[model samples]
Target chain A: MSKKDKSFEVLMGELETLVSTLEGEDLNLDDAIKHNEEALQLIKLCRERLDSARQKIDKLVQSADGEWQKQPLD
Target chain B: MAQLPELNNTLSVSQITGHIQHTLEQDYGNVWVKGEISNLTRHSSGHWYFSLKDSGAQLGSVMFSRQNQSVRVEITHGMEVTAHGRISVYAPQGRYQLIVDQMLPAGQGDLHLAFEALKKKLDGQGLFDPTRKQALPPYPDRVGIVTSPTGAAIRDMINILSRRFPLAELLLIPVKVQGEGAAAEIAHAIEIFNQRQDCQVLIIGRGGGSLEDLWAFNEEVVARAIAGSSIPIVSAVGHETDTTISDFVADRRAPTPSAAAELAVPDKIELDNRLSNLGQRLQKNILNRVERHEQRLNAIQGSYALKRPVLMINQASQRLDNMQDHSLRMVKEKIGNYGSKLDGFEQQVKALNPLSVLVRGFAVLSKPDGKIIRSVNQLKVGDQVQVRLSDGEVQSTIDSLNSKKK
Candidate 1:
């Protein structure tokens, strides 16, 4: 999934995986640099998401015709 | 009807009492009664003896420890209650009483009874089994809330959820929390959320209220919906002390609606700290790897193998110089020895010199043909000869022949 579409849970999971892989004893410098860059990017994305999040509230209402619709709650 | 009673056969009081006990116990094997509690006594043995009475009549009641252990509400004198039990006769006292198994406050006793009954039934069906409970997602993308739209419970939940984790969207299904169709609406909302599959977790709860006001949460329908939900649910009902059937059936239980919101999602501050830590660790690891590689590079550059060619050339030239010096020394020593040998040979040549003997007055003779006449027999008479002395030579002819003795 695109970075924007990935859930916070998935993003955090990927970040953790990268960090641990980089921490291993035998990884070459090239691979370590690559993983480090990717992990830092993920951290940036996660922080931005956490900082910019605004709780979106939606109220679900069923119409008289028996169809359910959702609208933003005030 | 056909046989006449033997009135003359007098019956003892115990016999009459036994008959009365059998009839009364058999007729009221199980019954429910509503009355004001009077003369309540909690005995040391943990049994409760009380009287259930109206103005006209009173019924003796005894609730054993085992049955009353599960009763959550407190019972006091003059409090109205609804009690369920079988009738039993005390033969020795000639009295019958209600052996109460359950009791609740009179006003909402029916709802409480229903709650207990549904709790027991669903528990027996293993709907509340820990194995059946699903794990809540660590990071919920959306939280489905089933509650009244305008209640304080929803407000509190929204406040807490927004403060802790705003990443999750709150999907609210506004429903009547109590009145007639509240249970059906709550159940339907839960089912709808499950069908949509949008919410990762659900919080079903309400603000604290009287038992009647919170009856919807205690309904069998709501409990069954929670049990059958594909999404894990956190049930928050009433206050910290109040518990509903929904709480027992849910995957998790929170004492209040705000607590349920907290349980539904993770806090962002903790995640932020963790992300920072991971970033630091990544940087450290990369730096360490680079430093190690650089150190290895430096060691390789300064290694002996890289400088070996020049060192080998220098060593070969030094060996060549040493060999040259050794050969020159050998040549000089040989020349000196040969020079002394040459001087000795010069002295020997002087000793054997005939020319030097001539200097001492030795004469030499030769025939006219330049052949030296070493014997007198070599010359014949009338042969010309030459005589050589140290300084002069003379030519002469032989006139007489002389024979020499052998």
Candidate 2:
């Protein structure tokens, strides 16, 4: 899938792999540090995604064009 | 004719009616009658009177306080009940009435025969089978709520979902949740949700109420709607004990509206906590790896070979250094021995050189025939002799030299 279309589950998989790569025995110190840095960035992004999420209520209202469009709920 | 002696005999009305009543009671001791109750009334004396009517006829029925006390249910309009009593006649009114002792509601316990029939039918079709139930998504992106917009249920659900997980979007499809046309509205809303793919799941219900108030959810249309929905539907029809047909046909049944909200999405806080736990594990793994590397470093640093690297190198180089001096002395000694032997050989070679005799001022004579005159007997007296010096040779006739004995 496209990067932007990646779900939280996909991102979680990536995060898990990154962490394991960092901890792997065959990994060199520089590569391990690099993987750890990338994992930390992913963790930060995931945390932000979770913390900043807000539920929005809306209704599917039929407009004059005979199409259902989203309108904010009261 | 055999006993006609009483042709002119006239009896009193009370005595004749008493005999008739006794005969009627003796003929029909007890009977059960089933019909719809109409024109029911409760008298001031705690007596219940009604008419049991069928399409063909109507029977006047009366349940006195003494007899009606045994009846479990009250006789009401349009209620078909099977009553147990006897047929009796009132002589004064000259009309027979049924004296009901016990009454049992017949069509159903409380007008739910249709409900049972529909449930049986739908169940026969496997609509309510557990296997047909869909598994709800663990993390729904959006949830559509098909309920009355003005109800506390929607408000409670919205509030619950928001508080539990704010990640999922809520799409409210407003509809009447009760009364006329409510079932159609509910079904329409579900259809819309399915048609538009509005949300991942649908939560359909109203607040708790009586069966009459909650009839819309019990409707066949609503049940069919729930069964046909492409999206998984969560029915939160009424209180926990109240199960509507919608609840039976739904993919999942939530006892309360707030519980449906809880079922529709994952709790973000729990997920966040899990993510944080994962992050900690990730860091712990890295720390463990780095600690292993550091331990290797400590091992190398504390090693004896590494601690005294110069000594380690010196031990290897000392073998080569000792061999270098030995090889150098052997080479010089062998060369000196060869040099003495070469001088002896040079002296022997010099003794064989004729040029050495010239340097010593010695001369040797030979005959012109290149023969040395070793003996006078071998030489002619007039032979010329040639004398050879170190630097030059003179050519002459050989003369007799002396014979020498060596």
Candidate 3:
């Protein structure tokens, strides 16, 4: 599955689930390795999402016509 | 004499005055009195005497300068005020008055009473129920803020939120935090945020202020708006000691705006540490699995079933070597027997040798014409013969033969 679309929380959750599954018994080596690779990918994606984050701040203002809209704030 | 006994129950004026003092002081201690101030007198002894009255009744009041100094509002004649203190009795005059320790403008005092009344009404409606409080999102992608644009509350919240988690977008709705219609403004901002539905959480607060300054958050409008919000709101109204009605109805309460910001987001450093730990565990687990499999393979390879062919070959070679040793030993024994027999044959051949016999004087005769004289009857009178002895052979004439009786 493509992990780029997943949110940080979702990716972290999937990584946790996969790691726990790999920890369980009765899994074959092939499936274990596959899950390991996927979990690693999820970790990378989560780290990137966290590291690349830059906060965006905005102010809600009313126009002369009385329409409310967001204006970017520093 | 009977009337004189009843007259003994009459009390002294001082004792009666003391009783009245205790009764009035005990009953009216720690009371709040609201009235229009009249007959104000600032004594040279740092005490002010006044009377609090509405249209129907008036009560004598006195506030020492020490207590009045802390009163923020200016108190004047005919200005409505609320005074808090105990009743004190002047024993000599037999008069009781309120001893004021704190005073405030009538409007601000009314706000406190109103706060209590609204708190009770909303509590009865279960607006402050824990079950009604929504759980704040663990990770919010967007946060809405309702506060004064120019205040430290907004700045502190922004700084803290950015430091903790920079992933969430902040949408601020700047509103007047106090004064006329401030509560309506705050309520409107909350409604707007709810309508937008983009923010996962909202922070509504202003920095520490006087009760009147923080009164907007205690208003019913703001409290109801916070309670009715679909998005979870964190109320951060004032200092740690100050609690507002909005704090009660909110999904979560923070003592200050900065604390509310912290409550709304997860720390990125903690997440990073968790991710690193999980990665290590995963790698360690996989490595352990591979090592176990390798051990299993080695065990299988070393098992007797896999080595059976080489074992069988070794056993066969061992048996063949034993048999070879047995046959070689028998052949050696037979050769030993033949060697003994050959020695016996050599002795027997030596005994049959003619030279060995002739050494004892034995002789053999042969006829020169292939005839030999053996007996007198078969032999003619003369015959040529050859004689062989151990040392020589000779030809001679046969002269006679003697025939003897058998």
lDDT of 2 by residue, B270-320 (tens): 878877877787778778878889999999989887879877679769988
Predicted structure with the largest TM-score when compared to the true one = 1
Compared with the true structure, what per-residue lDDT tens digits does model 3 show for residues B74-128? 7899999988899999998878899999888988778767877899899999999
Q: What is the C-alpha lDDT profile of model 3 across A1-74, one tens digit per residue?
A: 46776666667778889999999988989898999998888888888888998999999998899889899875
TM for chain B in all models?
A: 0.58, 0.52, 0.58
Chain A only: TM-score per candidate: 0.87, 0.66, 0.78
Models ranked on DockQ:
1, 3, 2
Residue B317 CA error for candidate 2 (Å)?
A: 4.3
Candidate 3 structure lDDT: 0.89
CAPRI classification of candidate 2: acceptable
Clashes of 1: 0
What lDDT tens digits, residue by residue, belong to model 1 across residues A1-74? 69999999899899988888888887888888888889999999999999999999999999999888999988
Residue B349 in model 3: shift from native, Å?
Answer: 42
Where model 2 places Cα greater than 4 Å from the true spot, the runs are: A1-5, A9-39, A64-66, B1-111, B290-314, B317-406
The DockQ values of the predictions, listed in order, are 0.63, 0.36, 0.52
Candidate 3 positional error at B402, Å: 59
Q: List where candidate 3 sits over 4 angstroms from the true fold.
A: A23-26, A64-67, B1-31, B35-80, B83-103, B291-406
